[model samples]
Target: MVVTNIAFIPARGGSKRLPRKNILPFLGKPIIGHTVLAALQTQLFDRVVVSTEDTEIAAVVSQWDVEVDQRSHALAGDSVSVVEVCLDFLDRTYKNRLPDTMVVLYATAPLRRAEDIQSVMNLLDEDCHFAMAVSVCHWPVHQVLKNHGDHVVPVFPELIHSKRSQWDRYYLDNGSTYAVHVDAFQREKTFYGHRLKIHEMPRARSIDIDTVEDFEWARYQAERMLL
Candidate 1:
């Protein structure tokens, strides 16, 4: 049976770290524009929807020729989770016509490619409830440091003596893309479900723009990749 897929992008206006991050210009188009375009280019999703409370963001999404779901004021706060935005979009727009699968694309992930999005969706099987993009940890846990009062402490003090090769490799959520079975997502109300799969992405493509420095790096990387 052919499964229906919908792509949902949540972009709120209130960004404390980087103001107007969703609509911020990355290369030439806004940051969210790249995500919408990538989702559309995959041609795997039946519908591409942008959930935003900001009119400017909605307008930018409209320019991409995709549907926009006006997010509720209650769900527009910084504390509101991405899952909440997606659930709100489903309840408000697709109450009766729910899709078989949902792909949550991050607006700030300008370097996320269409192939990566497709790969994550393809990773989701009948038994799997969630598939997300992940990247190998840049540094071993033992090498990581934390600040505690006036002292600098190792994040994994117990493993400080352990060689990096001694420990199993670790992966971190890239926050670029996520795919979920709609029924499972609705029931669990989260991306993490019983059966989960991960699509490993290269660190270069896994850059999540949350600050001006990150955005600049992404822009430089995107330009280089384009060339």
Candidate 2:
């Protein structure tokens, strides 16, 4: 059925730090499976599709009741930007008629919850064309160290001794949820288009699994939740 809101998941099969990380098992299921389940549970999407170039990954995602876009090799390389993958799907699936909104969920961040996903989407409005999940910075950088040949100097000496209240607060993309107006996304060829908004997420559920150590840490986090 045609719908105005779609959830697009980009799960490429190659990974240098962790091979097949997109489908790596986590808490008795593929890591991507957790994201798929969360997206479905939110009930915010009219359609949820996983776009991947690997048959193996596609085979695994097929277990769920979601559409799988067999992306081309041109969009699967490590250097290729994720925007290309998303644009390819949008151009092909919707053609000239585009959905009102599209949500991009990464497969690595499995701990993000359905409520958080909804919160991210809820942030989209006329004033904000891009909305995403972010986690408050634990150690917000007040000054940077720049090394000249033999010695290092503070980049921003003025901020070196500033109090926490005086320092600017910082937030980082948690690599979990992102929602954007389809029109703005195509116009800018990126998700970071137009007025951006954020839905703050807890550090506990903001884990983006990229390496073996990250996987282990995420497992510890998820296991603790079950208890």
Task: For residues 1-227, write the lDDT of model 1, one tens digit per residue.
Answer: 24388998888899989999988877788889889999999988778888877898887778776888887888999788999888777777665657889999999998999999999999888789899999998777777899999988888888989975698888999989999988889899998778888999988889889999998888888788882
Model 2 score (lDDT): 0.90
- Regions of model 1 farther than 4 Å from truth: 1-3, 145-157
* lDDT, residue 175, model 1: 87
Model 2 poorest ten-residue lDDT run:
137-146
Q: Which residue pairs in model 1 clash with each other? A: none
* Residue 215, candidate 2: alpha-carbon lDDT: 94
Tell me the lDDT of candidate 1: 0.87
TM-score of candidate 1 to 2 decimals: 0.91
Candidate 1 local Cα displacement, residue 88, angstroms:
1.9
